[model samples]
Target: MKTSDEPIVIEECYAISQEKVWRSITDVREMRLWFFATINSFVPEIGFKTEFLVKVEDRNYTHCWEVLEVVPNEKITYTWSYAEYSGDAFVTFELSKKENQTRLKLSLTVIEDFPSDIPEFSRESCIAGWNYFLGERLKEYLEG
Candidate 1:
């Protein structure tokens, strides 16, 4: 499938507190458990940057991230790119309290079109990745 012009947004509701969800996303230690174990470090402060290597088969995709905006436990926005690819994107995580549960929304916006030849850059792949992270991995990490 071709890359969609609109941002890819995925939402999941977790039976956990907003604070817990925020920490899971912002704290490096918690993130490592569910998001990216290869991530060396991550900070929620604006302008902070981090890079990590994710090896898939024989190919290596160096994931680069830069914090753009942070609203404490409410929201965090960052830029996501790969050093090996000629594309750029922004990923935003937003949290809101819904009764006793927390609603997590992940938004991915591609600023530059990624290489069409790369299957990992496809829109379906991106959506599936977010679903696994937020709906399955993070949910199990938080509630399990």
Candidate 2:
């Protein structure tokens, strides 16, 4: 599904255990190790919110995520928006077991209402970035 200017949609699957992968994501300590530069806090409960200071291109940006849905180590959904920009986007993490390995899929949807300031919200870039983060950084962190 296309959202305004976001032409690309990313679909990436990671191989890991549900419990292990869930920790990598919802656990604040584990998230700071691979996901964020500095995470303020991580509360997995639904409706709970958290913010983090992320550095992209040498610029520190404050991003906030509101937990939308949580199903233990099975799935988690949230809406993310950066203070430096506008528009709220949805991100969903789905976990499934496959041959004793957890198959994790992350889906990001750029809300139809694109960010006003950050007009460079290209879905293709988002896809590639997530691929490196979830598929690479998180993967390597878990493997190690």
Candidate 3:
């Protein structure tokens, strides 16, 4: 498993336009379909913020997110942290058009160290969660 010190980056290309990909990531309606279903609201503009609860087993994680940067259909960056945890991280999604496809690169960088003992905070767990969300859930939602 990788340490939290190293940023996790994952890239995938979809047979879709950059505008479509951007909408899926930035728009609350589209985001709810593939990203977080419980997301109450989301805006691509900087300084926008939202929080939602996610339950896993008996543990509840209150996910707090703040949009830090936005570049129309090309890029977006935001802070992702749990209200119940001490760690802080930034998650950025970049989109680029290639012919008839859009390539998306997702990067997660940890600024403050999270509790290492928690299974959910493990680097491996983070990677798996992203893979399931972006590589599987998002992919299926866009393709299917």
Candidate 4:
């Protein structure tokens, strides 16, 4: 259980250039390979919007996202929410170059509370999902 005020933060350092990491995150083609396979379109520009559906168990979650901010090769922020759920959140990805490597910091801030009845919406699940995508999945895609 997580309070609405607490943000989920995950950081990982990748042995790749910031440009490559940025493309993997912002490009829909690269993202679908590691992040979300159902992501139809993604643009790292302010006000760009995209929607996709994710099925968990018997429930369908319509994920609606709108780009809030973008700093090419550096940072991007998006407003993330579910069309069928009463919740609002902001997902921000920041990249910093350290010599030959890039440090990626991901932060997810919940603005509105999601239904507690759904186990998938729990804080633990959210943290685990991000860790899997950023720590394992993305690393493998980039390093491989």
Candidate 5:
């Protein structure tokens, strides 16, 4: 497993209400629209588990997730890992009301090492992927 001392953080301030942004991240149906296309189902309650497969080029990654913590509309945390990989990580989503808008902060921290040989598992790739999902796709989904 690959180890890292730092967590990847991505923050975005959207012109939407905190409730809307919280729903988009915590609700399974809303997540499918912007978070992951392959997410079959998800629940915000602690201990809820879900897995889905994602294909990148010729490689298939079975992403497994288990909810670890939840704070209503404020925050959620989950354990993230791959079915056939050695890496483990924690993903957290936080939302705060900033006047009429919402500030969303996404954080991903590596708990164990992942296969270093796979380019898709690299820190840079992970950051880029999160940026695409939380920064671009989510923004478009909310603002559009």
Candidate 6:
């Protein structure tokens, strides 16, 4: 297991079934609607390659990640990397099913050997960002 000294975890609870939540997480078309502005290609199968393009502050941030593991309706894990930053990330999404509703827990661990001159990436910003992207965006999108 890879744990980060600089931790990043964001969990979002959904008032929905586990199957619906799983579809929201993995269904490429629905995902592109909420998560990524443009996910060029996505397949949940392990070893699949994917890239996403998102615009923030009028700037385009290209996401380069790979599907690493998939436990059907249970969890999805992936590795993320960015060219600008010299770091790798393992993002895991764990789902807990309920009779009436389900909850999704997301944990992202980032490893960065950032130069001292460069500022450390703000975990606060990252957390809030995911909150908006996954919680507000995806969750709301699914509820509707």
Best by TM-score: 1
lDDT of 4 by residue, 1-144 (tens): 334458999999999999999999999999999988999999898999999998988999889999999999999999888999888889999999877799999999988888889898899899999999999999999997
Candidate 6, residues 1-144, lDDT tens digits: the string is 123455567777778888888888888887878987587777789999887666566555567889999999999999876655556778898899755678788888865543234323456566777889887998789786
Q: Write the per-residue lDDT of candidate 1 for residues 22-112, one digit (tens) a residue.
A: 9999999999999999999998999999999999988899999999999999999999888998888889999998888999989988888
User: Per-model C-alpha lDDT, please?
Assistant: 0.91, 0.75, 0.89, 0.92, 0.89, 0.75
**Could you give me the TM-score of model 5 versus the true structure?**
0.95
lDDT of 4: 0.92
Model 3 per-residue lDDT tens digits across residues 1-144: 223468999888898878888889999999989988899999899999999999989888999999999999999999988998788889999999777789999999998888888898888899899999889999998988
Model 5, span 1-144: residue lDDT tens: 256458889999999888889899988899989888889999999999999999888888899999999999899999999898888999999999888889999988888988889998888888899889878999999997
Write down the TM-score of every candidate: 0.96, 0.84, 0.95, 0.95, 0.95, 0.84
Which ranking of candidates, highest TM-score first? 1, 4, 5, 3, 2, 6
Show model 6 residue runs off by greater than 4 Å: 1-6, 58-60, 114-120
lDDT of 3 at 105: 95
Candidate 3 has which clashing residue pairs, if any? Answer: none
Off by over 4 Å in 1: 1-4
- Among all windows of 10 consecutive residues in model 1, the one with the lowest summed lDDT is 1-10
What does candidate 3 score on TM?
Answer: 0.95
Better model by lDDT, 3 or 4?
4
RMSD values for the candidates in order, in angstroms, are 1.3, 2.8, 1.6, 1.2, 1.2, 3.1
State the lDDT at 87 in candidate 5: 85
**Residue pairs that clash (backbone atoms under 3 angstroms), model 5:** 1-113, 2-113, 2-114
